[model samples]
Target: MRVWAHDRWPFPLPPRHTYPQSKYGLLRERLIAEGVCGPGDFIEAEPVRWSELIKVHDVALMGRIRRGQLSVREQRGLGLPWSPQLVERARRSASGTVQAAYAAFQVGVAMNLGGGTHHAGRDFARGYCLFNDVALATSRLREARLAQRVLVVDCDVHQGDGTAQLLRPDPHAFTLSVHGARNYPFKRIPSDLDVDLPRATSDTEYCAALESALATALTRDGYDIAFYLAGADPWEGDRLGTLGLTKAGLRRRDALVLDALRGAGLPVCVVLAGGYAPNIADTVDINAATAIEVAVRRTSIDRGGPDAKLALEPRDAA
Candidate 1:
């Protein structure tokens, strides 16, 4: 499997910032160390072109971001300080998802080690997301004639407000977000299908809701590709997430989503979304498990196995 990563592109953040910037690099390293991915399988992502950004983002917003002209209020809403490096990193991170989407056509699945910036809208940036990468990917794919119908399965703890805002109007795209009803960006934009789970929802409850939602979302056929935002923040230990899912539960969540997408014969592009465990290692473990699940499924599809089963079964706990 080919994986796109942009963790090498450093961005300035204030000391004690809560964005968990280091988790990207940590997740990449853990994937390699655990033999789920090899060093050669990783691709360094380049900054996406302004032309692509304009497809999903407003030209005025792009200009302000490029010129570092964001006002104090805008920066506060972005939840990160603006710098040349930050802008570059955002472009590179978005590029990872775009590249992964293209790569998924060659392989059954591809991944971006750092993406899922789902909170950035056409004219606004918020929730630590400067650009809506998945929306951008959907637009680019349609422009390239690579895909007409697209599916976005966002499993992040927080709603994919930006993605919904941008893509919900398009009949060719379907967006499904299963997030905590009480999480950040409380004023939610409606997705094509939104499954709002209560805070502290357990593994059984979350998984059941996700399965039912996927069934409903998949009812609309003709999707050429799928983008899965497999966020790790739903873990019980996450500082930002109030859900009561264990690492094992998160793994099960991955299996359910991946199985559904792959079963539909849709190429999958995976992105590591939000995860904010108090111990960064815990976050890394969850993301790595996701990478491993993707790799296992890819291998199974390539080998034409009878069943695309997971090589590493879900453990009871982290």
Candidate 2:
């Protein structure tokens, strides 16, 4: 398996500032220590150009950010205390996803230790997401003609409102969001396919829903590539996630997506979506486990080992 990672410390971070909406660094740190990924596997991508960002974000709104002219209304809507560190952190997080996508396209699977900020909208940003990396990557792939059809599998507990909204008019990319029906972003923008589950949903029901969704996305839609937002927020211990999924349940969710992608002959690029645990360490651990699962599954397939391995194989017709 040619497992790889993207360098995500793209923005300069600050020392003291902290908030629930701004603490995503732990996801990157844990991936390194747990052998889920290493410095050797990581590739530093050039920061996404303004042209690439402008493809989805409004020029006027982006200009204000570039000028560091943050407003009270914008900051509050973004769910952060306005500071250079916070601003830089959010910006780099989005860029990391685009970098990960480029990496994964060349290999088979790659991950961005930080990204999956799916809630930022064009002409606006929100919900700890200054920019929507998932949307940005999808847009780039489409504009560059790298993919004809793209599938975005967002399993974050909260809806990917921004992603759904941004691509609602664009038909080339299909957005599938499986989230807690009662969670934040109470209002939703329609997605190509949305499976909204009730709060406190258990393992069996969640898995069944996820598997059915994955099968439909890969088989029915005929997407050539996919972006999987394996959010840690779905874990039962998460403070923000409304649904209660045990660690095992979360693993099953990841496996279902991975296997489905392989069965459909599509490559998947993973992004660490959302995780807000009362204990930050718990959130980091959750993301690390998913990363390990993807890596191991990738390895087993390359070696053609015994257990079910989620690796892409070209379709016979192709």
Candidate 3:
């Protein structure tokens, strides 16, 4: 039930910025307001030590990003203006995922309110991502001897190209990305398992594909932890997402993933990925639904019973 986040996640950006930075705050507030999470459920993201960050990121890239010395081309690829606040936010977000992973080892499940930066590579950032939080966390966890094997379930509309490439040669980490086939970063990197859906794919099709992918991933043994990129961009209303999943469908999607992970007795660290609906409220609603679903299921699993049905209430209250 521990959710890591930081106030600086929503840095002051100029009006009309393409990235929906405000959604992070809105999702956090809505989760509390809707009784899905209590004020105590939140944990501020601590800054990640350089020693840990260097485990996954290139030292030169890290140095430039820290000093705000990224070249114009590098900054352009990052898709975020260089700022001291931005650097700090990226660091915190990376740390937040690591915290969530550690917390999940204690609890059945944990979350990072602003993570899933899968577009960030070891050497560079792209698509508004400065650090591959999940990748860095995976490396840190392995280095700490916390987990022997890891699985990444990326459901974002855009392919987790960076994550796939970063972990391509890593036998200990398994990457499974189910994303829009023709989405951004057209050149897709091969993951351990990739389920590319056609444009305008329906809810049933996406779920079926996901079920197959989950089954395949579960076939492997000895995975100690799972990092789920529960992206909300697959909603039909999303501006960037071409898929056509309804809100209810998206909720079902959340249940499917959470139930599978928790049912298998694996620790899961959930991260909110991309969600850019034309109506920001729609995006917020989808992300909130994910939080509620994970919180509910985590409680049920912790209580030593069947996977909890999606009741959308805090564990103590339930």
Reference-based TM-score of each model: 0.93, 0.84, 0.92
Where does candidate 3 clash, by residue pair?
Answer: none
Model 2 scores a C-alpha lDDT of 0.71
Residues 10-86, candidate 3: write the lDDT tens digits.
55566887788788778778988998767766666666777767778899998998888999999888788888788
Q: Which candidate ranks first by TM-score, i.e. highest? A: 1
lDDT of each: 0.85, 0.71, 0.82
Worst 10 residues of 3 by lDDT: 309-318
Name the lDDT of candidate 3: 0.82
Q: Order the numbered candidates by lDDT, best leading.
A: 1, 3, 2
TM-score of 3: 0.92
Candidate 3: lDDT of 87?
77
Which parts of model 3 have CA positions greater than 4 angstroms off? Answer: 299-318
Write candidate 1's Cα lDDT for 37-85 as tens digits. Answer: 6676667666788877887899999899989999889989999999999
Instruction: Measure candidate 1: CA RMSD.
Output: 6.7
Distance (Å) between predicted and true CA of 194, model 2?
Answer: 1.6
